[model samples]
Target: MPSTSHTAPITADLVRGALDLEPTANGILPHRLPARARARNTDGQLAMAESQPSGVRLVFRTRATAVELDTLPTKRVYIGAPPRPDGQYDLLVDGRPAGRATATGGNTLTIDMSTGAVEHTTGPAGTLRFTGLPERDKTVEIWLPHNETTELVALRTDAPVEPAPASGRRTWLHHGSSISHGSDAASPTTTWPALAAARGGVELVNLGFGGSALLDPFVARTMRDTPADLISVKLGINLVNADLMRLRAFTPAVHGFLDTVREGHPTAPLLVVSPILCPIHEDTPGPTAYDFSRLGEGRLLFTAAGDPGERAEGKLTLGVIRDELKRIVTQRAADDPNVHYLDGRDLYGEADHAELPLPDRLHPDAAAHRRIGERFAAHAFAAEDGPFAQAEE
Candidate 1:
């Protein structure tokens, strides 16, 4: 914590809508996933995604022309691969895009999949300062990088800052995979979920973790316990890509996940969303692989390596997951009407694909994110039978 004697210091409390903030020796670690649930997660993917702080932002009321944030970010580096984009920090003034930044000087974690070995080398923390804003006091938001695992070290502004008052908008809690994690999206605010939240006029608590969003019980329990007027879980892609479970295990896991979430939010508008169209994974089973041929061409692409024949063995596919999701939601909705299902294809389908191809063949590009967000806002939040209509009303 920096001294507020000169410039006022802001803490995680000023960072509105985070699921949980755990005190760390450095400062505070904003966790989209809670500690108890994290303990149950043995997968490294979830650990990295949770710490990335997608949709996490520092919200405050300030008149300062300049604001500075000190952060320690853990960035991953893959050997024999192109460098990942630098982490981006998005700034909003009075709920509009104001500026953007990339924090330098962070620890690097070297990953070598050839040997399944990892190494970390620490670096000094860096400060990001956003300045030249209007002098009048206004609501300001600093959206943390959606990809880098960031630990907030300190927050300082030229003027004293206070937590921004609640916007009175309903909170939308969403859990999904990389596409929802802002995978190929240009910036934090441009992420599909964030764009949807903005378009729907709601506060967002995004649980979209890249390479995660498997039907983890802890995630469901977290959603169960969180305060949200609207909740949604986008399923399928990660499970298919990771090949973590068979259809037998997946079906029950989805059911159990929903069952657990209902334990806390029995009546909240809980929407179950199936994965959107991924041509490669629609019929083919995955463990997807990166197309390294395009890798050197300055384009990174992924291909579904799982054979189409694997479906005979009950392997999971997006098509299969979608059917199962629709079936489960329909069956559950008969007894629990507040629960609903949205075909992910409705947001992005074959038609949308023809116009806006997924650049990476897995994640949507920035424009596609906006398109999905708009479609989602219309269908899931604004439609006559939408879950949000009942919940928000």
Candidate 2:
């Protein structure tokens, strides 16, 4: 017997973690940063990262035994690098992963790093279907691909669906670099932030933009406006890699960013996390470039481009950034008890690096992501003195 299929319109009320939704030609596109914040900058990498929907998902309650979603994904392609895999959609039934699926066709975004050229090729949307679910009412969460820019076109189920009721969980808003953006992670729900959120028993709003976590004023402003019970900003790696600022500018920028966030969340638990172990950039500054020598050998790796001697002229490195961050947070914590600091090395440090090294010399691999997520959960949520412990309690 054929099962009845009910089509449901994808609307803002059904989405979570995204700040804004843009009405697209075929569907709705989620944006981590609202339109006003996005309009203030023109960096292509940042623009791409914000639209990838790292922590965004659709949450609804239904008794459907089968479900389907139509999407238009913009998959990224590096002209000279290895082929990237198609994005996967992770389905969580009642907060546990039940199934995973990938769409068949979507648009392709090709990038030529050698010439800094980009090309976009449009294609038809594809559908992802899941079947054989429990027929009783349950909360269903469809976590979108963390690394792909996806548009929610349509949703179909065997039964009616409604927005899930609030779980009364504290919202943890986090902002960081590529590692936190699910780089090299297995799937959306397996990303370190997502895993940590699950362990912490909190809702997550991840603003981790890949290669774009520089302390931008717009990003600070956006963080200031967002509502969150707990907040964390992981800085330093992008600043070091991008060679965006030096010691003098970095201190002021950190203060300004924290000040802006405190304006809206004066009493919220604000955690400032430093960069993790990246040996390549620990003492050396960047403007890191791909190792073309290894690329031909079917390996994608990175090399530091800045000279070590440049450090004397105020070029920032991980070491320098960590010290500055600790000092700034210490100075501010004197009056504001809510602001706290966490050394990122405590999450993924020298020992972890030796056991599970970063595959690309930049991003952590799947195993490392799980390790970091577990460590983060223990340090941030389980510890009685941890910054996020109160939320869990």
Candidate 3:
């Protein structure tokens, strides 16, 4: 059986009706459905209406200060997650904040913009509704308060939109730090992941979290669990800047993370990417500092020095770590046939650095993003025998 229960139609009317329920005087509703709505739960699963052409189900993980949702006309937005009272999220349609919803520390909050009803619940799910979406493609921006950290777990449209044919395309799973997460990228679409995915003609799952891609085991587990035909892990820079772990732990941790991923994607083509040339960290271990006050003065500077007494304990420099990554991957390739390596320096080197330096001397600017994307696509995808090589017809 194809599971008819899972195939139940999800309709706008059902969504509208759900939103139509009035909140009590206390401005709260049951997070779980009423017993009656539960009766309609097909096999203990909440049935979402089948996606319509005008609606889509966009699902991915994001850790960003701002996020945008792209959808069609007549689309609505629904969210289900544990609420954080101290954390507030702004929902922007197009470029302006369309609605502001607060997290009440409840299990869920449902916003029915169609009825102008904002409902809070304690059970386990939340919804945000936007009626009268523009007929053409629309972008919903979720801007997090500065320095606030959050993840976007899922996004979907109400209607069934056709997925582009996947017949000949390869999938790419890329992991990196803030830059990869689209930090300071002019727009979401201009982010390197989006740009690279578009250029390579491949599906992409971006696990780039701003300030959180610290070779965490949980992240490695997440990557291990994801399905993909191609995988690349960008390491360094953040580790150096944050000075989170010393070399002893950092090297093994990197190996462990890669090991975990390889366990799940044994034969999948894996590319381990080292950090690009960073002069500040090129010779010294850095707990880099910035003077935000000097931003308007057009004078941003970073100071780097070897940690006193910790230098021989092996604090990692960009140069040292890059060599270690190359050695590690080269050694692993002795037994793993599909594993490969990319020196991030190859993407942007000292020469390129001199020509198009990063504004922060840390993260690249928009122009640098385009340059890196182009180089990545050429080296990683355009190569005929590379991981993203097109399949035979």
Candidate 4:
């Protein structure tokens, strides 16, 4: 364990990329969305997702060989599935992986959709320790858990620390669903978007919300207002799994979303990515349902509940969404050449699925996140004739 020999308070100024921070009784809780937007958002799911700090981190420069951060993370507990492990804190030294740790003891929110019952219980905050560094002055980053809502209580190190030096990389703003939210990823630094951003040498502003990327106007507006050099939105699976809207509503919603974004970034490279191959929702319309049979075994999987015949009635399937997204981007590109589209399958298709199956039957596993991130970097960030062709320099 790292020694808490030299302690320093972690103030709001030390956090980077968080839109807002609320002072808590013990410390501070970082928020990815502003309070005004949060006030306007009535959806509990959206509120929780936005407050989870997907791309937020504590960044600093230090000469210490050991460090510790005390935090209270609010972790979710699902009734049907086994409890998720404590959220991971990723440590990076001079832009490279150093170590990973998880804080112990925090509140728990146990939800039971089967009965519409909810329970909340509190626990003690714990420390995340990282020891044995190079002992030279270096930039260090501690990426907060993307899946847990954490309240930072304190920071301790063997030496004083300051904010990290800026990398000056182009900022990449990306939005998507749970897959983009780092679900099942080992840590915040390894999410597909995080991996892709690291490989492409871009700063990340992630808007990935677990089961909550519904092409909301506020989300689009938020992306518009945020300063980003490269932008991408991964769409489809959430729509299919949630069965949120039919094709008629979904089409206009997408247009509205893009229209809102382009209002602020008129000429920036914008990429629209369709969903990857989720065989369960490929040809079938959905309202994906839980596979209760595996629940007792401590494995949870989802199956498309909507019928294939519903597609003719304008119900959405991943295939339909992909075709529509491609068509929309292509049509708009006739006038707006900076806007482009990439098939999600290009990042992770049927062949890749056979090799790296989605453990939850929907969200990709950690290894799959790595694969998708690498592929996305290759196809979108490095390929010639792509929107980010000049970004390679």
Per-residue CA lDDT of model 3 for 362-385, tens digit only, reads: 777777877888888888888987
Model 3 has an lDDT value of 0.56
Q: Write the per-residue lDDT of candidate 2 for residues 242-346, one digit (tens) a residue.
A: 889888899999999999999989999999999999999999999888887787778799988988898899999998889989999999999999899999999
Candidate 3 global TM-score: 0.61
lDDT of 4 by residue, 29-117 (tens): 99877776677788888888887877788988889999889999998998878778888889988889999998889998999967757
TM-score of 4: 0.96
Between 1 and 4, whose lDDT is larger?
A: 4
RMSD of each: 2.4, 1.1, 13.3, 1.6
Worst 10 residues of 4 by lDDT: 384-393
Off by over 4 Å in 3: 1-168, 296-302, 305-310
User: Each candidate: how many clashes?
Assistant: 0, 0, 18, 0
* Top of the candidates by TM-score: 2
- Please list the residue runs of candidate 4 whose C-alpha ends up more than 4 Å from where it truly belongs after superposition: 1-5, 391-393
The residue-level lDDT of candidate 3 at 248 comes to: 81
Pull out the clashing pairs in model 2: none
In the range 185-219, model 1's lDDT, one tens digit per residue, is: 88889999999898889999999989998888889
